[model samples]
Target: MIGLAPIFSYDDQLKRFLLEDVGSGDVTTRSVFSYEARHRKASAKIIAESDGVFCGGPFGSRILSYSDPMAKFEAIPDGQPYAKGECLVAMEGALESLLLCERVILNLLKHLSGISSLTASYVEMVRLLRKSSRSLRITGTRKT
Candidate 1:
């Protein structure tokens, strides 16, 4: 879909994010997994830390794939409501690869969820207020 095309197109941005967080390879993960670790498979689930809207499923998938092409990922559909501790992403791949991409994927999920959650709250608040006055609406101001 067009939604996913943008993610793949922004190679520099994704690489920058990884480079900023993980530089010259992840020493910690590398130390734990040896060169032969690519054959090892590991599975992990991303759990929500707080209640919010799930808004980064696709982003998470893309980030993981970018970090490790062999990493298998499954993320919940975006723009849906989720409760705290809900599983947002399920990934199974090489242990080292999973560890390397974990932080970036989680960070993206957290950021997107925060924005969607706030927007959802504001919409709910407006809905409640709108019930009292159907004529009241949120509108953009334009100057002629």
Candidate 2:
């Protein structure tokens, strides 16, 4: 099984992305949430709007951890199949922290999941077609 080790290997890249998205600080979250409110506990979940092969669960957990070390993040394993309306990730943390990382997390999840889902569909097609040709195979390239 693919584990968190592979996800941790991308820490540097993920940090760069978080830094780019959260340059200086999150002005909106800071302004909208008073000091007390910022620390108020909140819980949220990312629900799938469509069926797809879920990806980035570990990365999502890592992103949330960066925002608030005490935050709790739980998600289905990456590469798991999900259905529309299913919860992909569930997290609880300070309101400010959650809001700060929400966009970055959502964007990553959507982008990665889309690619995984599409690739799964292509592989399924190949599997169906391969019955007629024993030598046929489907492989991925690093070009993307």
Question: Among these predicted structures, which one has the highest TM-score?
Answer: 2
Per-residue C-alpha lDDT of model 1 across residues 1-144, encoded as one tens digit per residue = 555656455667767787788887788877766778844888999888888898877767777787678888888888889889888889998787788888988887888889989988988888998998865555556767
Q: Pick the candidate with the highest lDDT.
A: 2
Put down candidate 2 lDDT per residue, 39-134, tens digits, no spaces: 999999999999999999889889889989999999998889999999999999999889888888999999999999999998888888888885
lDDT of 2 at 27: 95
Whole-model lDDT values for every prediction: 0.81, 0.90
The TM-score, computed over Cα atoms with residue i paired to residue i, of candidate 1 is 0.83
lDDT of 1 at 122: 82
Model 2 scores worst on lDDT over the 10 consecutive residues at: 1-10
